[model samples]
Target chain A: MSGLAETFAAAAQEQRGVLIGYLPAGYPTHETCVSALTAMVRSGVDVVEVGLPYSDPLMDGPTIQRAVDASLAGGTRIADVLRTVESVAATGAATLVMSYWNPIEQYGARRFAADLAAAGGVGVITPDLTPEEGGEWLAATAEHGLDPVFLVAPSSTDARIAQIAGIGRGFIYAASTMGVTGTRDRVSGSAPQLVARVRTVTKTPVAVGLGVGSAAQAAEVAGYADGVIVGSAFVRRLLDSAGAEPETGVRAVAELAAELAGGVRQRRPRPV
Target chain B: MDPLPDPSGHFGRYGGRFVPEALIAALDELERAYQQARGEPGFTAVLDRLLASYVGRPTPLSDAPRLSEHAGGARLLLKREDLAHTGSHKLNNALGQALLAQSMGKTRIIAETGAGQHGVATATACAALGLECRVYMGEVDTARQALNVARMRMLGAEVVPVGTGSRTLKDAINEAMRDWVTNVADTHYVIGSVMGPHPFPMMVRDFQRVIGVEARRQVLERVGRLPDAVVACVGGGSNAIGMFHPFLPDEGVRLVGYEAAGEGVDTGRHAATMSGGRPGVLHGMRSYLLQDEDGQTVETHSISAGLDYPGVGPEHAWLRDTGRVSYRPVTDDEAMRAMALTSRTEGIIPAIETAHALHGALVLGRELGPEAVIAVSFSGRGDKDMDTAARYFELLDGPP
Candidate 1:
């Protein structure tokens, strides 16, 4: 099994949800992002996704969108993303890349897989590239022995879930809602049902993402999901704090990651 | 001669549903609804009546004798899409999609607009159908095309200004797509152009096909022969595809699509996707996109707000690759010049988007000489653009 699969397996054995955190590379600055991921890792995040910023992020809400836009304006490139991934991966957490498909398509999928693998990256989360259109990417990831994670939403049918499960390698990301990634007051009521639906088709571990912001929300998701994925919340923290003090921004993300990590480790017990 | 996009919505690997999983079911539902609606007798009857009465369809084909004489004596025929209700060809697709929304029992209609033409058209359709309407326009476009904003509001549609990510057509699309994802149950996203994920490119084209269908029959009946060439400007490529689809089988008719070249193609300040881009994915479809080396979509510039987009429709990419159509760029200077000449000679003012086609047609007319019968897709009227045109031409006396 791949290291990513092993991480999930270990988490399963521990009988607790795994906490996964996401941050865009070169957000604020390259060095700051590298330190941010390190701080997140130190705060008990079991895995980290270093986002490769793209110009058009259709699936992201305003928070991540603003972070990525700033990263791009700061001259963030694929190289910077890879460098951040390498530095973060050195912390021993299973590191993945969260990105749109175009950059990889432009970067040559095979070359991207090889470069990412060399950087200790274990997988890629492609928000836009469906399994139906991921033939070349699938082959490249297979060749590099890296995980090709795919997302399944509440709108996905059983057959569609099966098809995605058939292609997914690391884990199946289950979107908690039907909208773009952002912090919501409440996680959608449909998330647990969707995860249960996915479980009916594939044994692949399901990680719930989108709208997971607060620790309480993470704890709620951790009760039902194998993994809790938090993104826009962390991005919002960094963006809000970076205005005054960069160190405060980094500390804010780390503290939130730690709180979410605690939530995953000690999930709130549901009433009988 | 082939059915371009197969069942998977692929046009030679260009068009497909590359959107997030949240939008998949909505797209599938739209596809199913469109498939059923297109074949329903009741649906077609209402659509046909609406097209004739509400949209003022079967818009005339005008022979520009003076303009033709000015074009080195070649014959120029204008497919008067500019005369359509709401002053642009956008109403055709807007009305069709609005009716589709009505059929699906959707209460709200959402759309994204570049120059606000599509927003106004969608607002007009939603008003006619008694559905609530909202539009997302880039902050820059809303500022530039303020009159169109007023027109949309007057039609009872609310306009949301998108201030994120370049603040233009692309951002507006992103914002609208987000809205649809969040409100998929009660709202329908009426994509203005023939772009985005699957059903949209095909659906919008199907709605707008009346342009080519009418122009083809009119040209043959009036001129006693097929036109030598057809020309249209391509932004997201709705009008061009509409004007070109029915003529695809006509071997003798040459289809040319002109893209907006802001300064010049060589100057790196243009929206000529075909001329300046490589195949990539943006706005849910794999098409020729203007993006940087890092695959970040770059900001595009054009004097015409409608043409300032970083990507073209997937079908246009396929048509260009297949050599069934020719794509070229027209600089702002050339398009503006053609707009002035068209207004002066034909006494018909054209939207800046249409001026790109006029510029291309003028060049083609000069090349083909007086024997050639060229058809130009006059996509929109210039009343909304009079402010920009007057400012550019120094015709404005003072700040209004």
Candidate 2:
């Protein structure tokens, strides 16, 4: 099994869902980003999704967009993202890169796959790359022994879910709502139904993302999901702490990650 | 001739669904509604009635002898899409999508516009059909086309100015897509151009193709032969695609699309995607685009707000690759000069977007000589563009 599959297997043994924390590769500055991801890992983040800051982020909420803008303004490139994956993966957490589709295609597919593998990265999660458009990426990932994680939404029909389940090598990402990436006041009531639908279709581990912001919401999602993914919430913490001491922002993110990890480890009604 | 776009909405690997998975069911529903609407006379009757009575279909083809003289002596004919309601060919698409959305039980309409023509057209359609309308425009474009902002507001549409990433047409499109993703259940996004994922590119092209279909017959009746070349300006390529599709069967006729080169393509500031670009995906379609080495979309500039975008329509990308049609660029100065010349020679003030085609015709006229016939798609009028034109040409008797 690849490192990602093994990571999920190890989490399943512990009777707990994995806690995935995400932050852009270069936000505020490259050094601060590395510090934040390391802090998040030290606080029990099991997987790291190093975001590749992009120019036009259509699927993001305002907070993520503002953070990404700062990241891009700091001159983050694909090289920076791979370097980040290498460092964070050294902490023993499975590391994946969440990106929009264009940068990967522009940075030659084969070269990117090989370089990422050399960096000890696990896989890639493409929000815009659909199965119909993922033929090249699928081949590239398989050749590199990397997982090609795809997203399923609440709007996905059963047949679509089945197709995705059959193809998932890494955990499948289930968007809990039609909303973009932002903190929500409540965990979506319909998210459990979507997770139930995905479970019926595949043995592959499933993760729920989008709007899971707090410890309470993380605990709620851990009831059914195999992984609890937090993106904007982590970024939000760092953003709120900006203009303070550098270590202050890092500590804030570490604190949130520890709280979320506790929620993931909570005993739930559903079994792994 | 190849029976495209395919069932998956791809035209030779360019157009397909590249949207977030949350919007797939809605896209599938739209495709079904559109495909069924094409065959049912009940649907056609309503669409046709709207085009004929509401939009003034079968717009006239005017002889332009004086304007031809201003160009290099070739006989020039103007396809007057400017005469259509809402002052551009945008109405052709807005009405069709509105009717389709109504049939699908979608009560809310959303759209994005750069020049405000499409937004005005969409707002007009919504008013006529009694549906809720909301439009997204770049903050820059809203200020540039403030008259159109008032027009949309007066038509009962809420105009939202997008203030993100360059704050232009592409940003407006991104904002609209976000809105669609969040509210796909009861809303229909009326995409303005022949861009976007799947059914949108094909659907918009079909509705706008009347420009070419009517020009084909009218030219044959008025000029006694098909023009040697057909020209139109390309933004997201709706007007150009609409004016070129029906002429594809006429292999002898050359179809040319003129893209806006803000300064010039070599300066790297222009929106000349086909002229200076590589194939990449944006706004849900893989098309020729202006992107940096890292694949991030580059900032694009154009004197014409409509053409100031980094990406072109997917079908245009396919057409460029297959060598079925040719594309060229017209600089801001050249387009403005053409706009003024046309106004003086033919008493027609063409939209700056359409003036790009006019400039291309002037160049084509020089190559074809006096005996050749050229037909140009006058995509819109200059009423919405008065502010920009006045500033550019110092036509306002005010301080510079």
- Write down the lDDT of every candidate, Cα atoms only: 0.93, 0.92
Isolated chain B TM-score per model: 0.99, 0.99
Candidate 2, CAPRI quality class derived from DockQ: high
Off by over 4 Å in 1: A270-272
TM-score per candidate: 0.98, 0.98
C-alpha lDDT (0 to 100) for residue A264 of candidate 2: 88
Could you tell me the TM-score of candidate 2? 0.98
Q: Whole-model lDDT for model 2 versus the true structure? A: 0.92
Candidate 1 per-residue lDDT, tens place, B1-400, comes to 4686788899998999888988888888999999999989999999999999888989999999998886778889999999999999999999999999999999999999999999999999999999999999999999999999999999999999999998999999999988888889999999999999999999999999999999999999999999999999999999999999999999989999999999998888999999999999898999999988878899999999999999999999999998999999999999999999999988999999999999899899999988999999999999999889988999967766
lDDT of 2 by residue, B249-326 (tens): 899999999999999999988999999999888999988989988888999999999999999999999999999899
Q: After superposition, how far is residue A162 of candidate 2 from its true place, in Å?
A: 0.5
